[model samples]
Target: MIYHGIRLKAKAGVTQEQIEETLESMRNQGRAIPAVKSFVVGRDFGGDFDCGAVFVIEDLDGYGEYLTHPAHAHTDRVGMPLVEKFDSYDITDDDDPQMGAKIADLHRRRYQSDPELAALVSKQP
Candidate 1:
């Protein structure tokens, strides 16, 4: 299993509704890709990014398929331009129950701890 995690910031002036819609689109896009075990997207509030998504796939082959998926490109086309910038982290999905929690904790910690990076992703100036 593999974990593909992501965070996104809406372009300055993009509406909140638009951001949420884009996230949902991405979740749907992830679902359409072959071998995607589970996928989700959501808005992160009072935090670094405006939105985020996560995808779990079987392996590198599946991950590759997801990357080339038309739905992914289409969602990217719709969502990317609407965001100032974004960040991502990928890790080998560990079978240990604690590993997933650890990875998720690290993701949140990075967001909560990094301001400059967040600003950069938000396209400040």
Candidate 2:
């Protein structure tokens, strides 16, 4: 399995609610894409990071499809108005379970330095 993490910083003055709504819309539309196995979206309210979304896809081909898919294009169109800066990472490992745990740990460590993110980490299951 492959994981795609998209970190988004909302444009100045954009509300968290708007970001959530856009993400939800993307989730709704992303369902049609066969390559995407799972999707999760989260918003960061108190730090430099504002919002982010994660996609679990079958392979690099799926990632490519996601970039060119119509739903994705629509998502980009909608999201562009709300995003200031966006970055993405492609993650993979031989073991899916281990990879997931590692990803969580990575996020935990990345966020641990920031008090706001540390609080967010404490809230995760």
Best by lDDT: 1
Please, what are the lDDT tens digits per residue for candidate 1 over residues 1-125? 88787788777799877877787778787768877899878876666787788898776567666665778656666776777767777778456767656555654554366554445435532
Error of 1 at 7 (Å): 0.2
Q: Give the deviation of candidate 1 from the true structure as CA RMSD.
A: 8.4
lDDT of each: 0.70, 0.67
Tell me the tens digit of each residue's lDDT in model 2 across 1-125: 77777777777798767887788767865587788899887775665677777788876556666655777656666676676776767688556656656555544554464465345324432
Specify the poorest-scoring 10-residue window by lDDT in model 2: 116-125
Enumerate clash totals for all models, in the order shown: 0, 0
- Misplaced by over 4 Å in model 1 are 94-125
Candidate 1: count the clashes.
Answer: 0
